[model samples]
Target: MTAVVRHVMVRGRVQGVGYRAWVDHEARAKNLEGWVRNLRDGSVEAVFAGAEDVVTAMITACRRGPSLARVDAVQEEAGNPDALNLRRAGERFSVLPTV
Candidate 1:
């Protein structure tokens, strides 16, 4: 199966709620390779690279986020594995600094 990548932007009540950490855990559980970070616009941004089904599942998971997060919206777009330019080759999923 070919791998696919997606760039996601999650908005609303995502900051200061351990959302990034939750995302990291979820991504790893799915064996995904990508990075997530906070944006200054009060949103959470993430990338998921893995099998198509798993990547799509990750996007669904982002819609709910952590218990503390009040997810308002989740926007996703197709992307290259290196589109974010944050993760190194062969690296596992991670939480990156805010952008």
Candidate 2:
């Protein structure tokens, strides 16, 4: 499996809608290594790392977030797998404090 990493920025009505929790659950279920957090500008940011296809699938899922979320945009770009900026050591997936 070819591994890849992606940094994503999700815009729109994502906050206060269990978006982070949903992402945490989904990424872990997909065996992805990453972190999700809320940004200062009312946006959500996340990093996903794993097999290319799986990561791609995760991004697609983000576009249609949780039932309560109204995802407007999903911006994705290449990420550095070696430096995912994980909050705690040895954690597979994390929900980081808002930034």
Candidate 1 local lDDT, 1-99, one digit each (tens): 689989999999999999999999999999998999999999999989989999998999899999999999999999776664687656788788888
Location of the lowest summed lDDT over 10 successive residues in candidate 1: 81-90
Cα deviation of 54 in candidate 2 (Å)?
A: 0.4
The TM-score values for the models, in the order shown, are 0.92, 0.95
Candidate number achieving the greatest TM-score relative to the actual structure = 2
List the pairs of residues colliding in candidate 2: none
Best by lDDT: 2
Cα-based lDDT for every prediction: 0.90, 0.94
lDDT of 1 at 78: 90
Worst 10 residues of 2 by lDDT: 80-89
Model 2, span 7-83: residue lDDT tens: 99999999999999999999999999999999999999999999999999999999999999999999999998765
lDDT of 2 at 74: 99
